[model samples]
Target: MIAAAPASGPLWQQVLVALAVFAAALHVLHDRAPGLLRRLRLGLARRLLAGRAPLARLLGRWVAPPPPAGSGQTACGACQKAGCAPRPADHMRNTP
Candidate 1:
């Protein structure tokens, strides 16, 4: 039997092919098999963060949030000026 070339042309015509392949691989690994494959992703993220200050800062920005205070959340300036609650240690302990 003889095979014929596709009328639309090559299967991988452009960079789209590389992107599609990458997306498909990620989908298959993470979406189709999340339970087993997720650890691989977690490990990759951890390794990427290790020993890289920019990556560490990016990850820190991603994971940590400023301490919350007051009612409604505010993204920029103009938040309430009330200071955080003071601890009991702030008061003097008499040593009679």
Candidate 2:
């Protein structure tokens, strides 16, 4: 039931415009609402693989589950610094 593009432009041009719009929308959604995107992806995968145990297992392998809580690590490497803090001896030696 999709409507055809106007005949004023070539089919290739119409396809390109549609693809550009789709890409832009995806980028905006990815930046503005990442959680929503993740949920949508999970929902889509579930719907696609509904009632299929083997397929579900394959999908699970492809999309690993999130790490357990209190793992002390994050996707971003902003965890505790190792040996970055200045010691009292260093401060004393540097003092004028």
Candidate 3:
């Protein structure tokens, strides 16, 4: 029986593994604490893109808040119209 040698990957593989771990950690953070992540992104964008209105507008588009629950309309200024109308509740009553 041949013995298997210990596995040692190349430097690039090690770097890739580290990057994957970092990305996974970021994904978890974003999922678990989306509000915190959004605030951080907005703050960074504001700081980096200050005094640049066009760039700020682009960043604002990315960091805009999500639509209200069940509203089916985005809070972003792109939509000028209101959201969908609320459905009326069924009014049928039990009949003899």
Q: Rank the candidates by lDDT, best first.
A: 2, 3, 1
- Give residue 33's lDDT in candidate 3 (0 to 100): 99
What pairs collide in candidate 2? none
lDDT of 3 at 51: 49
For residue 90, what is the lDDT in candidate 1?
Answer: 62
Q: How many Å off is the CA of 56 in candidate 1? A: 5.9
What are the lDDT figures for the candidates, one per model? 0.62, 0.71, 0.69
Model 1, CA-based lDDT: 0.62
Distance from true location, Cα of 73 in model 3, Å: 8.2
How many pairs collide in each candidate, listed in order?
Answer: 0, 0, 0
Q: TM-score of predicted model 2?
A: 0.49
What is the descending TM-score order?
Answer: 2, 3, 1
lDDT of 2 by residue, 1-96 (tens): 999766978889989999999999989988999787777777666665664688775785455435456876644453567655544587778545
Model 1 spans with C-alpha error above 4 angstroms: 1-13, 56-96
Give the Å error, residue 2, model 1. Answer: 32
Q: Which candidate ranks first by TM-score, i.e. highest? A: 2
